[model samples]
Target: MEKKRTISVSVVNEHGVLSRISGLFAGRGYNIESLTVAPIPESDLSRVTIVTDGDAKVFEQIIKQLHKLIPVLNVVENDDFLEKEMALVKIPIEEDIASIEVLCRAYNGNVANANEKYIIVTVTDKPYRISSFLKAIKKFNPKEMIRSGTVALERY
Candidate 1:
């Protein structure tokens, strides 16, 4: 059966590693829902967090293929992963700024910036909470919104 899955991979920091890893999925006809990659702090490795929904069997095959990649150091299927996402919404200045700030605070966010034209509010929370924040903020009629890909780290 198909289900949402998050896989965290540690790889040597180098050029074209992202392309190669992503290409592996594309070559297999797998659809990646979200991907976030960044170099590990004070280390020669990087973390690549991928979110996808697909058949378990196919997913395993992809995992196996990932292991064969030369740069890949670790491949962890999220068993105890903590995930978070961030979002920013631009709302018209005419809207109630206080109310918007209140809403943002509810989602672990705050007014990131503001001017005479628009107010940008940012929130970082679990993915589902980010979705809920987006939905709830719709009542304010935000002018623009952008969400970041999921960043995950495995728990001890």
Candidate 2:
């Protein structure tokens, strides 16, 4: 069964590593829904979070390909884990700000600020929750939207 999976990779901090990793997915005809990369604090390594959809066989193949890359240090599929995504939306002040606030609150989100021309709403939640929130908020006519790629950690 094809399903969403989050893969966490540790790699040497060097140029082209991101392209190599992304190229592997592209070559395999797998779509990356979200990708986040950041250097590990005080280390010469980087962590990459990739969200993809595939069955077990395809996922294993993907991992094998990643491991073959010279810069890749480790690859872990965060199946038993907690994952979250964040989004910030700026909407024109045409809609009722109070109504938007209430909608955000319903999704465990918040309207961070309101100004004369626009309002900024922030949401941090599971991927689906964030999607739903965005869909719901669309009725207000968003002026801009920014989504952070997935970030995940294994559950103990």
Locate the minimum summed-lDDT window of 10 residues in model 2.
75-84
Highest lDDT scorer: 1
In model 2, where do residues sit more than 4 Å from their true spots?
A: none
Q: How do the residues 28-78 of candidate 1 rate in per-residue lDDT, one tens digit apiece?
A: 999999999999999999999999988889889989999999999999995
Model 1 scores a C-alpha lDDT of 0.94
What is the Å distance of residue 36 in model 2 from its true position?
Answer: 0.9
Q: Each model's TM-score, in the order given?
A: 0.96, 0.91
Across 1-156, the per-residue lDDT of candidate 2 in tens digits comes to: 998889999999999999999999998898898999999999999999999988989988998899999999998886686888899999998888889989888777897888899989998898889989889899999999988999887787
